[model samples]
Target: MLNIPLWKRVVIVGLVALGLLFAMPNAFYSRVEGHNDAVAAIEGGAESPELTAMEGAWPGWLPSSLVNLGLDLRGGAHLLAEVHLEDVYASRIDALWPEVRDALRDQRATVGTIRQQNSAPGELRVRISNPEGIAAAVQAVQALAQPIVSLTGVGERDLAVRSEGADVVVTLSEAEQLATDQRTMQQTLEIIRRRVDEVGTREPTIQRQGNDRVLIQVPGIGSAEELKALIGTTAQLTFHPVVSQTRDGSQDPGGRNVIYPDLEDPELFYILERTPVVTGEELTDAQPSFDQNGLPAVNFRFNVSGARKFGDYTAENIGSPFAIVLDGEVISAPVIRDHIPGGSGIISGNFTVEESTQLAVLLRAGALPAELTFLEERTIGPELGQDSIDAGKIACIVAFAGVLVFMALSYGWFGILANIALILNVGMIFGLLSMIGATLTLPGIAGIVLTIGMAVDANVLIFERIREELKSAKGPARAIELGYERAQSAIVDANITTFLTAVILFVMGSGPVRGFAVTLGLGILTSVFTAIFVTRLMVVIWMERRRPKTIEV
Candidate 1:
């Protein structure tokens, strides 16, 4: 028998006890009382004032925030979106074909006609009068190719090309298209994750689904409309000169001036047409604040280059108005009264606090590459989440009671020891989750329940082994030792298979499914430790005291 020291056993128990003690508040207590209370002042918030205030009261120990629950259990929004890769590919090809045509023209190739063909998907056909110039034209077009490749016929001088379907199909192979698609999806996912993170969501789940879709799940998020507004709108900011009207039946002699729609007066203001000196991408920071008139506005600061450009534009067009256009709509158009030397400027307009903040966030994050459409949206209320939690708790308690009774009735004192270890195992899972700040979903709760059943299977294997060894006339201590040794392989094999399944599920699943996988994986690991270490420790202690000659199952 592998003899473990009493001190080692005591230390393990003490550590488990300490974990349970620290996890109590997270598992049960409410440190925040009011909804309007500052998030930082409430427990589980980024900066808990209560924790700081009580830091001195609890000596040499840090107060932790409450463990956050997931969307299913906590009731939150779920969104599934299919990214329109086909449209993206089409736009890319359209842009590329123009460039290719221009390049062909530059090559001095005699171009007859170039157009997209409906005969083949993603195919474009180009016909040229000069057969000798075909080689140079193809070379020129090749320079701008992305997911497209050129093909020359045996008897014809025409060029035929097709796109392999990517975000930007210049002239790319199938492998290259797949690679580009993966990269685009990954980059978009990162951008979305950053945007969601900026919204102060806790444990938000964002993952890529299939080759062209993304799934986002936010727990405890009640405002589906707000989230949809924030995420679905592709805030593509651009600066376009307003088209000017002519006095006569001819075009205006002066440049185009953009027309701004007045929100209050419904009057149109024709602003002088000026090319954008700088884009919003040069912006460094943006935040909502009140202007001199105390109206809600967004204060924005640009980089050095942007500041210089803005200053120059303001200096040159002092009397002319410039419009702040966002997503094709003119939000504000104020004449340059004075030169703006610094990179900072205020956008004064009619805005609520939420609108101002959202605008600032969008500007800070930069413009999206393409427009996004919302295909699905769902929200879970807090009341629904509470009910789930209540149901989960009842189910777990009943499961625990049933398991405890079955073990005790079948295996006697040893079964009671196993039950104690099982309880401790559950405590450890919660404690670890709290320590790591893992979000617990409804599926995650199911994972724990399933783990309880699996964990008992390991105990049953060991107990049956002990019974068999005792039937062979082995002493209690020897039988216990042989039981653990014989059962270790079977226990490890069974758990390993389950662990592999969890790993695969985590890899392929999205959102709630992933949460379930994570919880199941963690539960299995902890169960192994408790079933082997804690159970052995208890049995060894009992054997040391009672010195039973034969074991009973």
Candidate 2:
């Protein structure tokens, strides 16, 4: 211990200094946050006097990373939503209709004329005029079934077709329904994440709950309703051939026709074909722009397949009207003046610039395959978070004061060295948290306070061992060296077990439990380093300078 190397001492001092430097920004958290935001905005081509002032709030040379605060610490919106997975079943059945119809139409001589009949939810029935051709019609529809590629459904086909008298019945296989639910859940999660990220909310917590629910906690959003508005719209955009314009809902729309109202005028409605010529899924890009009339609009481009279909439809149906529908409301219906061969078009609507921008964002993020019914929603205020911070600060201060006084009273100058190391350990924790962009929460603060009490364990063990060696009439340097060597195993054994517990908690827990685990795990690493290297290095330096005949412990 007395013979510490020159390189080791330099490295120890350098690390401590670096940690304190990284942690300094937290002292002026708001200023550093402003500086970071200003810098990001300026880089993004935004310029203003306010931005310039914020840029100068903190020095550019200093480290600007700050520990992000979790929702419980910063306040935000929380929601628990149950996904309506059954909603996709009906749409899936409707989607299979075109393929089934085309297959049956190809064998028109045998099947005669086939017409879709009203059936139960998630089932499609087709009636063939020639009852003797029921077997042929079922075989034709069954040919459209595709193999499912999932692990649990590897050998199963997605559809099952059967004939009852002159009617051919079609429904999704059980395995296919299971696969669809899984896909819907995954797509919903991904789309919601993208939408939230586009808005740039800090440290949002979005996770699956049970099998059919999602839990969302977004910090910095005003309320749960605001967040719902941002992600709730399905954005299911489609282009359909308009059958007729009418305001009568009670009138029959006829076979395969649906009535939808205009987005701008609720009373004005358009009857349209149930199946769309093209859907938003085929879109590759969408951006907000002004149309030829200098009105707010969204310009969208489609993939190759969509482009071909759109071009063919427009070319064949020139002079007919096609409606652009979004989430069941007709946004616009313009007559095709010419063939739109490039698969790109502008959608003009009754919208403000902000609405157009949001629509573009949603289009780019894709649509939610199923609906979300909110089970719970809450808005946590900043004042409540401020109270949590204040309480945590008081608890930490009290813990630090008690630890500092106890150590100093027990070991004199060596105690003071331990206290300094303890302070640096805390700084290093925050430094590491900032480096990784960790979000600190209330439970995480408790972990830090608990760490403060645990950090002195190794020091106490080493100091007591030194006292024992001193009483045995050993030299000061020899006693210090033997104390650290003897207590090393005990310290290692104790911390290792605690570290394992932290690892297990991190893996098995969620939300607040995870926050606590992260802090505890990081604290263990920093505490062990400060205890073994930092305090030991300080003692060695002091001993080498003083070279005292006697030492007090």
Candidate 3:
């Protein structure tokens, strides 16, 4: 304990230096953040003299990462949104219409004329013209049934086909509904994440709540309304072949065709085929652009498969009109003048520039599978966060000062070494937090204060042991060595137990509790290092240089 090797000494000093260097950036948090943002903007293809100067202000080689402040410390928007999973079920049933029609049409003689009837939200009802052929019609539709992939219903069919009166009703099975809900929730989460990330905010907390809801907390956003606006729309875009144009939305457009009102003129409706030629899922990119008439519009391009399908469709129906549908409303219906081989086209809706840009962003992020209904929302003001930060700062300073005074008065010069180690210990905690990008909440400050008080336990144990050794008439050097050697086990045992408790808290807790656990955990590690390695190094150097023959505890 008294004599550390040359390499060990070098390592100890190197670690302390690195900790100080990494923690230095947090002292000027805003400046470092500005520098980081400027660099990010430059990388994102935005260049200006001001951004260049800001980037140059902070050196690139220096440690620039700062500890992320939690939502409680930095004001933001909080929202609880319930995903409308039931909405997808109805859409799924509607989409199955085309498939069911095509399958039954292949065996028209056996199934006879098949017509759809009104059914429940998730059920598809087909009225068979020939009631005697119900069994064969059921068999034909059963061939289209898929196996459910859920664990509880692995061998079950995706659809439940049954006869109700003269109509055959097909509904999603329980297992299939469960699987669909899971997929819908996952897709909604991804789309929401993409939209939030597009706004360029840092460290937004987006997590699943229950089975059908999501909790979103975005720090630095103005209000919950603003955050909602970023992700409110469904943005479902599709292209359908136009059946006819009419002034009446009440008129039936014929079998498997629907009438959708024009977005600009509600009285005018376009009759379109229910099966779309292409959907937004095949879109690779969408950008805000100007149309041929210099109107604000969105330009979209398709992936390889979409391009081939679109190219063939346009080639076969050059003079036929296609309607561009947005959320069941026809935006435009234009005749296919020529083969659009490249699979890129413009959507002209006479939109404002802002609307066009927002549409482009939504398209690029992809459409939400189901709508999200905001259940709870609130805005956390910056004033409250500032007050909390101030209180936490005062608590930490008082705790730090009290610890310094107590340790200095108790063990004399050795206590002073412990205090120095304590300071370095705190610095190392911050350094680790910043390096790992861990969030610090108000509770995290309390953890730091707790750490400051606990940091001197090992030193107290060692000092008392040294006094006992001195009373037995051992030499000062032997007494010091025996003290550290004897007290090491107790120090390790106590800290190890405390560290395990912290790990449990971290694993089980969320939000501010997690922030507290992080700091508490890191504090335990740094305090142990500083107490054993740092203070011992200081004492060893002092003893070696002064050649003290006797010492007082």
lDDT tens readout by residue for model 1, 1-553: 6598778888878867876765665643444212213433454545655555544333334435456788877777888877765543443443345566677567553544443322222344455555555655566676663432223222332223433321112333454455546656776677677778777777888877777778888876667776777777655544433344222323333321234444434444334343355667678888899989888899888888888988887888777666676664566766678988997888778788888888888777765545555678888888988999999999899888999999999999999999999998888778777777788888989998988877788899999999999989877878899999999999999999999999999898866787789889988987888888889888888888988766688
Better of 1 and 2 by lDDT: 2
Cα lDDT, model 2, residue 412: 94
The worst-scoring run of ten residues by lDDT in candidate 1 lies at: 149-158
Query: Candidate 3 lDDT, tens digit per residue, 1-553?
Result: 6879999999999999998899999999988989999999999999999999889888999999998887788889999999998888887887888888888888789878999886666778999898887888788888889988778778998888888766788888888899998889889888988998998887888877789999888888888899998888878888899988999778978656778999999999999987688888899999999998999999999999889988999999999999999888999998999999999999999799999998999999998888889999999988988998999999989999998999889889999999999999999999999889888889998899899889889889988999999999999889989998898899999999999988999898777777788898999999889878888899899999988889989
TM per candidate comes to 0.77, 0.95, 0.93
Best-to-worst TM-score order: 2, 3, 1
In candidate 3, where is summed lDDT lowest over 10 consecutive residues?
248-257
Residue 360 miss distance in model 2 (angstroms): 1.5
Q: How far is 197's C-alpha from truth in model 3 (Å)?
A: 1.5
Q: Which lDDT tens digits does candidate 2 get at residues 412-498?
A: 999999999999999999998888899999999999999999999999999999999999999999999999999989999999999
Q: lDDT: which candidate is best?
A: 2
